[model samples]
Structure formats: C-alpha cells, structure tokens
Target: MNDESWALSPNTRKPLPQLIEDKIRQLIDSGHFKAGDRLPTEPELAQKMAVARSSLRTALQRLQLQGIVEVMRGRGWYVRSTSVSDRDESLVIDSRISDSDLMEVRIALEATAASLAALRADDGELDEIAKRAREHQGASTEDKEELLQTDEEFHAAVVKASHNELLEQLYRSLVPKLRGYRRNSYGSAELHNRSANDHNQVAWFLKRRDEGGARTAMTTHLLGLYNDLATQAGTAAGERAELNTFAWEDEPRWRDR
Candidate 1:
C-alpha cells in the first residue's frame, strides 16, 4: 500500500465542499496550515476529500475571500494567516470567523452601542426599534431572512442612536457580515430565538432610554455565545492576547469623506 502522509484517514462521514472549507479553516487556525505553507494542489485535495478538484477549488476561493488563504498565479495557494488579530478589523472582514470571534465582536459593539443608544436615540429611532422587534417576533419559519434582517436592524439602530456617525456607519457595514457568520457558524434555532430576545431587550431599553439596562442587557445577551466561542478564540486571544492588542479604536479616523 502506498501511504500518503497528508491524507486524511477515511471516515464514514462524507464532507461537502462547505464542510471542507470549514475544516481547512480549523486546520489553518490550529497552525496545521502555517503561514507560507503551500496547500496541496487541487488534485491532491480532490484525492484527500474523495471528490473532484472543482469542489475543492470552490472551497479554496471562499477561503481566499476570507483572508485565510492567498492564491498566486504560478506558485499556487498558501495559508494567509500570521498571528491572527482579534480586533474590529479582523472580526469585521473574516467571512469564516469561528463562533467565538463573532461573540467577541458582538460584545464590544453591542455593549457600547447599548449605552449610547439609550442616551441619544430620538423618538423616531425608538419607534423604529419597536417596529422591527415586533416584525421579528411575528415572523414564522418561512421568514428566516426577515427575522435575521430585523435582528440586525434592531441592533444597528442602537448603534445609530449613539449619535456618532462613524460608529453608526461601522455597525451598518459590519452587522450584515456579523449576522451572516453567526448563521453559518451556529445555525441553531435556539440561538436564533435567543438572539431575538436579546435584541428585544435592547429595543425596549432604547424606548425607555435606560442606559444601564441596555448596557447590561447587551453584555449579558452576548455572554452565551462568548462562552461558546472561548475555546476557539484561544488561538487569537487567550494565550495569543498580547499580539491581539492593536489600538485601532484609539487611533484617529481622518473622516473628511
């Protein structure tokens, strides 16, 4: 028998392309795919997955966009990770960020917005928050997208209420991706309902302008997911917390645009 050192041992469970991408991400995240490491060619991957090269390519392209891998014209693809940064930028753009990274980002954004929202939101904004919350609650399973949209709208509205246009715009840009990652990473009905409940509290606090309550609610709401992601976040934040320290929030934005 010709033994291939790189081959994943055959398992009863077959992996789809999406699953393959996720597995590869876990490998990269765990240092199995180090920076400058050349991923095996498409045919090698196809053999390993017991699938076609095309599917592997599709997975690789998705990873490419996630900044998990970089493709070179002649040299082939290499793992793109260095010391992974866990701040706003890393969380904002990571298409396949683990559940823990999603939770961490949510804690920072949601808790901060909660207080700002309660303090600065106008009546119209408060009403909008109510309308979206009701809309989310009323949706049946057929309206998953709407439920998801309303969830984002409720939180983004809180960020907008902060009266800082930059924070509002940043939230606007990040929330869609945030929602998308959570859906992909968790995809649990219980988690979805939990997210809605957390959002409802934020909306309620917005209406009442209860700064302390909002902050506490947002922080508490994010805790479950944060705990869930904590094990995975060890790669970026726990032992690696020192490299994770980049003061982007303290850095000034040249916002003439």
Candidate 2:
C-alpha cells in the first residue's frame, strides 16, 4: 500500500487526528488492509500519513478504543476488523433487537457524551464538532448517501470529543444498527436540516462548557428519532408522554416544523 495515498486534504476542517483516523479507516475499508493484518510501526505510519506522531497516535487510540484495531506489546498495531462494530450485523436485521431498543441506548450514551464533552473538550475538538454540525446542516437532502455520511460524522465527532474512550466505543457499536433506519427516515431536506440544527445546539453548549445544556441539546436531538419511530409504530402519543417524564423538563419539540 502506498503511504502517500493517506495524505490529508489541507482544505479539510477536521482536526489532524480525525483526518488521520479517517484516512486509516478508509484504507482498511477499501481492503488495503484486513483483519489480522499487521500495520506499520508508529514512525512509519506517521511518515506515511504525513502527520505528526502525536496526531497519529491519537488517531490509533481512537481506532483501538473502538475495536477497529489492536496493539500488541513489543510488536505493532494490527487490523482487528473492518466492520465499524463487533456487534453481529444479523442481530440488528433479525428484528430481535428493534431500532427503538438501540435508540434508547443511544440517547443515554450520547447525552452523557455531550455533557462530558462540554466539560472536557479542547478548542480543537469543539471546532471539529461545530464543523461537522454545519456540514450536516447544509448536506443535500436529495443525496441520501451523502446526507447519511455527514450525519454520521457529526455524531461521531461529538462522541469523540467526550474524551471518554469507553463511552465513545459504546456509541460506535450502535452505528451499524442506526444507519439503515436513519437512511430511510431522511426523506426530506427539512428533516435533515432540523437534525443538523440540533447538532449545532449541542455543539454550541459544548463550546461554552455548559454541561447541562449540552446534555439537554443531545437528548432533544435524539428524541426526534424516537418521535419518528413511535409515529411509524403507532405509539407516538403514549410513548412521547412517557419519554417526557425524564430529566428534560421542556416538552420535546418532536413535531415542531
């Protein structure tokens, strides 16, 4: 594999570590490397990716935390699996685990992530989250694939900013299940843009280090998904009433245009 192929775009707004992370993930996804394949040493990888070792290490730590790759003592990093999560893809498809089930888990994990990120994220991390939110907000609604990818990146950046590896990993594990449902639901630009606005709200709070505000914003954002699922399943009225009993005192704007 050509190391120069991993060169990052100068125009990209993503942080250096994130850019490195994306490049490595892309290489793995494209089959340049596979599970159990050994990756180059730290120095080699940094040189190849044209990034500082600190940035490369940070990227690798995120990947390793998510179970994408494994590090061996006295040896080197190795690709663990190409799949985003180790969770069985069939579990999400078999209907044994409903999208609502995953949604509840996501709400809990992500709200906490946003709150912690607010307390801990550096300026660079905050900037990345804001950049992703804007990208998603302006994403073309007609292009389902592009919209989904942008949305994914925004959420991922938020979770990563939490600086809690375990929390980030747990959230990443839910991505595979969430993607299919989200793709089906993005039927209009309005919906996509609204979600993007929610992302911005979360980022805004994080930038100001307002933990409670960030948490509320994230919960509000996710409740949008809950609303859609409940409506589709004919449980909107009952389920939404039940959801409001949580810590978020404000009525959810699930139906707000």
For each candidate, give its TM-score against the true structure: 0.49, 0.64
Task: Name every residue pair that clashes in candidate 1.
Answer: 100-229
* Cα-based RMSD of candidate 1: 14.7
Q: What is the per-residue lDDT of model 2 for residues 35-126, given as tens digits with 9 covering 90 to 100?
A: 99999899998888777785676577657656787667568999988875562232344447777778877888988899889988889889
**Top candidate by lDDT:** 2
lDDT by residue (206-249, candidate 1, tens digit) is 77888777877777766655555554446434332111112365
- lDDT of the candidates, in the order given: 0.61, 0.77
For model 1, what is the error of residue 203's alpha carbon versus the real structure, in angstroms, after optimal superposition? 2.1
Please state the error at residue 174 of candidate 2 in Å: 1.0
Q: Give the lDDT of residue 14 in candidate 2.
A: 72
Candidate with maximal TM-score: 2
Point out where model 2 deviates above 4 Å: 1-95, 236-241, 245-257
